[model samples]
Target: MIPPLLSRTILATTLSVIFALPAAAHFQEIIPSADVLPEGGDVTLDLVFTHPFEGGPTMAMKRPVEVGILANGTKTNLTDKLVEQSDKGAVTWRVSYNLPEPGAAIFYVTPQPYWEPAENKYIVHYAKVIVDSFASGEGWDEMVGLPVEIQPLTRPTGLWTGNLFSGVVTKAGKPVPFAEIEVEYVNDSGIKAPNDAYITQVLKADVNGTFNYVMPASGWWGFAALVEGDKPMKSPDGKEVPVEEGALIWIHTSPMGK
Candidate 1:
């Protein structure tokens, strides 16, 4: 006969495997060193896949399918300049761009499809961030022509912490009705969540596909609008699964002076 304690341990391990879950929100982050620049110069960016609120257990990122910056009415390709960085057995990416002249730099990345065994599907998050240079205040409304993207109703930069952010979720150039958006604040390395569900807040767009969220804290915040793709992708085990298409946008807000 087996000891009761040994029996309990086996049961717990079996349950854990049976219902494996993702610990935090999976965000494809294209974060820059600074969101606003007083003067124009060079800026560095890090492309990572991780739970921003938890800081990370960084997920591996393959070379992105497309990467560029839309500025001065032109899109400049920066894929060749990407540098891969590895941490704790996971890989990420980095790049540096010369922010010449005064204007808005909208950097975007279309990451290669990432397969999640837990969800049993592939995820492709089209992520972007805006940097205001020299307070140029131009091109904040620029669009990247991605398959899925967010059109910011409010100016994407120079925002206050409590200001409301609103944007439309569009796929293939048409607005989606009642889209689902997931929100998360970049945890700045040490913010603790009260519970598992608290790590990622969920919201929905209105009938016109426009969504709003009030900035709750001062720092970088990411909004991801997820939808299903028309096509399905094959999994490693040879099963065809639906593809998750996400349109993600990032913005930074400042707190009032103390």
Candidate 2:
């Protein structure tokens, strides 16, 4: 038996360690400085792998395997433009693009399979976001033809904080019924979660793979719908590891009041 005071101290320390780490809800963010392009239709994008709600404890992201844009029914390879950066001692990527014409510019990335020690598997999030410029929003709904993607039913731009954002979860070019989606608000500052459960909100797609969520605050909110890839990939140790294919969409919601 141990002394009562010492035993209570040990238990308190153990519980702190247990509750310190929030559940693993990693998000691959393709966040643009501005959702809609300004006069010259120019915007810079920040790409990172991390728990967005916590704004920290970032994970390593390799240089994307593929990075490009699909606009006006044409796909342009922008892989050479990515500039690597570091934050919180983790590697991330960024790029700057100036839209030449006024069409719905859909920027996307296909990152190399990342081996996550926490999950014990490889993760690949095919992330994308739309930046509308010069009032050209007609083609914002076009699909990128990815293995997993979220097709926005609502225009991905010009959204208010409390607005309802909806999208269809598609896997392999088809709707994924009852898919699992995790929501996280980018905790830049001011906004916070009191507990781990409040950090990430989980939702299930309807029969048609559609899901919606209302933004609680004015900031960037990331939606990631996870699905198992059709094929498995090998881990760092050469053992066959399962793959998690995520369809991620990041949108910015503006403040509705002072």
Candidate 3:
């Protein structure tokens, strides 16, 4: 019923608006089979680069540049232990680690630079997660000395669903004032977001580079503090592109059962 010229114009506008909408935030996930090892045994870790909230279209991750675990004041390199995993043609990584002692094992990964054509930039997320072994409650705050990292103000593990998680966004061991952090939950329960806005929660750090968020659900929550890299990197097409450095940390929360 509409004029052909006007109809074409409207269709073009609609398509443009849809494409203009921001894509779901990319989270570098370092999920473990268990966050706490009450008895202290082997723990399996899955490393994937994906949109945790939307839950799919996982990006292919090359073998990490570095992977290690810090425990009992010692850092052990585990890069050679990584085994490649594939899902629907996307490459991921997995590692199995044994926790024989009682302490917090902080595992971290420095992934290869990923090129994002949509943003015309490269992404490098330094991600880490803690596995408390035997509930020792010790060494939970040890710094991995990553170039960019989230220094937890609160203990990073064994939390209730409604507990508050707070941390400081630091780059090169110094606070980054008012840093932007993106939070997302790993969608294991098939929960749906009512709108696109709910897919990723955004918050800014305080003047001291501290941020707080109370997770409403019980699952693995990831907080990524995004900051521009100090230097540019060569893109796949040989262009000099800026890098988006994300200091990411993941924590698990359990539901308070009746």
Candidate 4:
């Protein structure tokens, strides 16, 4: 038999050591093994930890971690960094890669579970994804709801109106002007054909988040603006620009002086 106070002290110390560390370690999983590479499009990659909400603290060995995507063994780092699940003690790292054209790419993360007591920090994770060019109508416009205003142009062919439009993209009721706007026109058939039905003119908003584009010719047009985001926003043709929600304004050109 031991003294009562000593017995209580020993029991408390044992409990502290037992609950000090994670019960088990985990690895990450890759999803959508194959992804469509939009012409000049940006791709987002998600690295999911087998453990939930293990973003930082929940990782093994408390190591410095990095996640990246690979193309033919060439690696590209993702920007999303790491995220943790507070409730479940799981973690995830999200990353983005730019795909110039359709091809194959591999992805992985490094230096995970970088702590001591070796048994807990046992898993290193990596994976791959298939990239291919996507057909039309399978891009950001499709991913997010495209606002279609499709307004008519006010001028004739090749005539510069010196007229400009003013507006700003807003989220949560705040103006967001740091974006790119493109005026796109559809063919007479009302369908943007793969060959020659789609026409576009790219422009940028002013300091006040305003723009003035002299309507050149018109069928149907809209404003494509870049919104606030983590990864760089890209056009269908793959031009890197600010990302933002867009508005579609219809334009019908008159025969000049109208």
Q: How accurate locally, in lDDT, is each candidate?
A: 0.91, 0.89, 0.95, 0.40
User: Which regions of candidate 4 deviate over 4 angstroms?
Assistant: 1-25, 32-34, 38-40, 51-64, 79-89, 114-121, 133-258
- How many Å off is the CA of 227 in candidate 1? 0.5
Kindly list the per-residue Cα lDDT of model 4 for residues 178-202, writing each as its tens digit.
4566554433334433532234455
Q: Write the per-residue lDDT of candidate 1 for residues 1-258, one digit (tens) a residue.
A: 889999999999999976666445689999998888889888999999988887777899999998899998899999999998985688889999989789899999999999989788899999999998888888888899999999999998989999999999999988999999999999884777787777899999999999999988889999999999999999998999999999999999898884
Better of 2 and 4 by TM-score: 2
For model 1, which pairs clash?
none
Residue ranges of candidate 2 with Cα displaced over 4 Å: 1-21
Model 3 spans > 4 angstroms off: 1-11
Q: How close is candidate 4 to the true structure, as a TM-score?
A: 0.30
79-197 per-residue lDDT for model 2 (tens digits):
99999999899999999998878878899999999888777888999999988877666689989998999999999888888999999999888999999999988888756567678
lDDT of 2 at 47: 92
The lDDT of model 2 is: 0.89
TM-score ranking from best to worst?
3, 1, 2, 4
Q: Could you tell me the lDDT of residue 16 within candidate 2? A: 100
lDDT of 3 by residue, 116-171 (tens): 99899999999999999998888999999999999999898899999999999999
Q: Candidate 4 lDDT (Cα, whole model)?
A: 0.40
Against the true structure, whose TM-score is highest? 3
